[model samples]
Target: MKDFITPDTGTQIGTLALQNPIMPASGTFSEDLADVFDLDVLGAHVLKTIMHGMRAGNPTPRVCDMPSGMMNAIGIPSKGIDDFRDRMLPYWAGYGAPLVVSISAHSMDEFVRLCEAVSLPGVAAIEANISCPNIEADGRAFAMRPDTTHTVIERLRGCTDLPLWAKLSPNTGEPAEVGRAAQDAGADALVVANTMLGMSIDVASRTPRLGNVMGGMSGPAIKPVALRMTYQCARACHIPVIGCGGISTLEDVLEFLIAGARAVQIGTATFQSPTIMARLVTQLRDWMAAQGVSSLGEIIGTLEIPQAADGVWA
Candidate 1:
């Protein structure tokens, strides 16, 4: 007897299409785990967020466990674009999936420079990390205003010819507005969020947890928040939305799809199980088959949200 787990469903991020919608979050899925599982089996691969300059990152005690998911203040430690191109790109090319290299910088000039540098030979696409703190210049906040998100993509648009995806932050007051900013700024896609900001403390020591005072929270705990934001943002803009934060199971992946996510990225979950991506990919296909769904695209965003008694879809 034959099995029914074949991925008949397919999707694309910009011009680079994918066999499935599941992918790992940047930085969380490292190149060091090649032995544990086959990265080629994945639909796509996004390299960790790299910067124009090398990053030492914040202090130790970087990660901690929370009730639903894990929290981290990793501080975006990258080897820099030049070094990443020299080393990481080679490994990225080895993987069969589309290679998306995430880049971050403080100034518009540095962002443009980094985009130009990394759009080298092997990069399939470039994802700009605008939420990072400006360690050298001023302070750092999630690219709160739409203007900053717009300006960064606009500046980099002229520099590199590669497809651009602006990674948005859920810590914002309005995710949809920022999504539109990315669209207007000429971004090919938008990552609905990086991580929501949350902090924890140890009552015993009377100090905050994690190396940094605050950090981005990701895991099963944030799934509902990510789902709602992704849905709203997708409806607000024409660009595709790559759902991140708290995506753990096939059910979670389905919820994101129904909520309007074109694709989903798996994070914190990977730290506990490197093979989760492959497993989830398999499960998605199997679930699709059981539902008599020929193509995943056929069911995406197809949820017919019933109108309220007052006749409002809300």
Candidate 2:
């Protein structure tokens, strides 16, 4: 019998290295998914955002389906740090993939506290969900502005030695500036983007589709926005950028990598196909081999467009 070799999909974000580039976006991932397939299949386990105290989340109708995607205002309901540490930590620690815990807070003090607490031994990295409202800033998200993004990342960086991944929001108009601020503040990587803030209306019912009136839109519909941000941040910052949007197939994964994302996160698409991530892992390896690619790094940030006569991209 002969041994077969698989192409390498491993990538590094800061000092942390992942076996593959596929992971579930926060809020869409959980231990329950382990039942569908092995957790080791993922590059890393990115847990949902955890708060200092429990959150009840938004009102009813937190989720609504759109024509091409979906909107969610689930509000990041959490059982708080204590429950997560005592209950979920042990189970996650059993997995081979690294655990990247996502944390959210309304104040700088709370963010610092959560960052310090989650930096325990065995954790691989910390992903700060800066899209949450900053109570001190009158409810504006920290990632909405360059200054706020710097303040949040700088403070959190000081609290932990673990690799810091500043998860930015797609709702912002200046994602490049935000990415630069995060890098200057010591972020090892950027997860370029949370979700786009959007709303849907029902004509016959004459009311908003979501109970929150507005929610974060995600799926194939938002891939273009996410891809654009990934390209901008990847070029504007030195740190790695992890693209998250509507990735469902090998092509989507390759597109993000080509656009400069060192890694990609699969979200809503997973809800429709539980084993999609596992399938993607195999598909990526096969595609690379078929294309005579030895490593994913070879194809990353390699997009090409012809220049026009006026010196602009055609």
How many residue-pair clashes does candidate 2 contain? 0
Which digits, one per residue and each the tens of the lDDT, describe model 1 over residues 137-224?
3655436668777878898888888899988888778888888988898999998778889999999998899879788898988888
Local accuracy of candidate 2 as per-residue lDDT tens digits, 1-314: 33455678899888988999999899998777878998798899999999989889999799999877899999988899898889888889998899999999999999999999999887899999999999999999999999999999999999999999999999899999999999999999999889889998899999998988989999999999999999999999989999999899899999999999999999999899999999999999998877778888899999885575464545
What global local distance difference test value does model 2 have? 0.92
Lowest summed lDDT window (length 10), candidate 2: 305-314
lDDT of each: 0.83, 0.92
lDDT (0-100) at residue 309 of candidate 2? Answer: 40
Model 2 segments more than 4 A misplaced? 1-5, 309-314
Cα lDDT for residue 279, candidate 1: 93
